[model samples]
Target: MTIKLNLIAAACENMGIGKNNNLPWKLKSEMDYFSRMTSKTIDPTKKNVVIMGRKTWDSIPTKYKPLQNRINFVLSRSNLDLKNCKDVYASNSLESCIEKLEDNAFKSVYETVWVIGGRHIYEAALKSDSFHRLYLTKILKTFDCDTFFPPLPTNLKKVSDPDVPEELQTENGIDYTYNVYENTQFGK
Candidate 1:
């Protein structure tokens, strides 16, 4: 069985994603969009799986630990300790997580497996053939950042956003919009 792996993120004009392991900017709308997209599933009983690097998991606030109503999978080579957080699992690598999802017990139970990342995890997903779509938010303003989103592969094509709810959203003097890119060579 094949799983549709997806990656989602928001980045600034400079492709910056974070500063000191935390989001560099505060855009409530953007955060809300992220929350909605990640939480959504065709069947409410089955939760989506979010695979994130360990640092990304740590960066989320304590109260938001498991990101509610979603299955959290953290990628880490170290001994992972979730500190009694419910609905969270640990994987040693991205491949391991994907392999686990391919398990018969989980394949039908999950909706979408999203790679919610730190820069490195995003880069790894971009290089893999298993990932299908990118739900990227293009932030128009520049921000001081220490971490950045990886460069997009030339093989992926950004689809038209005519049907997007907020195709072009401008808030707090910053213009941004959601963009979807599909792998041009995916099925081959």
Candidate 2:
């Protein structure tokens, strides 16, 4: 079976993911979604993996760092130490990170490999031919952000839930949508 890689993120209209090393908004539903998605045990034999950039890793609060029950893969060229992390791997390049995933024999073990990122890592993974799906939470407002996700690829087809609550709408004059995009090459 082919390894299924997924990306889960909350982004602003500007594709902004963060400002000052934190999420732009404090949507409880978004946090709930993230917690539920990442906390799932898809495979009893193998834990899910969360791949992220260094900044993204740093952005996570100290209490949530080295997220419980999941492998944390931090992509960075620097030799920064991530304390209290039991399963943290630092790689200099995305290719190296992917190679590590391959070497770990993930195909036979895990049901999903999640790429949770800030901006640069998200862009890198999306550009890669290996990634197949993106689980994105398109936030309804813009914020003063320092990091941004790249624009969605035109070749991919998006599928989204039509029954989202209207209360999630932003008062800041923006509309949010939860979308899942599958790469055309994957017969989506």
Candidate 3:
């Protein structure tokens, strides 16, 4: 089965996504947008899935996770003990996690699949055949970041999304815009 997954993240002008394994900047609105996008589901009985690298999962504050109302999948090569983690699944690779989602038990439980990231996970998601759309918060300013998002493929074309406001958004003296990009090759 073809699983179409969306990638979501906020990046500065230099494509910087993080610093010190945490968000380089915090904008409540941006965080709210992420929460809304990943948690929203048309079917009340189903929940969306958020896939992330183990580092991304670790970066999240304990109080805010397993990120309420969504199924969280953490990918790690090492055996991460998550048996005690509620609403979270640990998988060795994105493919393995996706395979689980394809299983009969999960097929009807998940409404959508989203890749919320770390550098390498984003890189892998972008190249996956399942890659569909990207919801990117483009920060107008640059930041000093040790981790960066991968450059977008030329095949991705900007698309408008009603959930995303077209007007520029400003927060904490910084300006940014919401951009939705679709893979033209995939014909969504």
| lDDT of model number 1 | 0.87
List per-candidate RMSD values in Å: 1.6, 3.3, 1.2
Quote the positional error of residue 169 for candidate 1 in Å. 0.7
Over 4 Å off in model 3, which ranges? none
Q: Candidates' TM-scores?
A: 0.94, 0.83, 0.97
lDDT of 3: 0.92
- TM-score comparison, 1 vs 3, better candidate: 3
Highest TM-score scorer: 3
Q: Candidate 2 has which clashing residue pairs, if any?
A: none
Q: List ranges where model 2 is wrong by over 4 Å.
A: 82-84, 104-109, 160-175, 186-188
lDDT of 2 at 72: 85
RMSD of 1: 1.6
Better of 1 and 3 by lDDT: 3
TM-score, candidate number 2: 0.83
Query: lDDT tens string, model 3, 26-129?
Result: 89999999999999999999999999999999999999889899999999999999998888999998889878988987889999999999988999989887
Worst 10 residues of 1 by lDDT: 158-167
| Order by TM-score, highest first | 3, 1, 2
What is the TM-score of candidate 3?
0.97
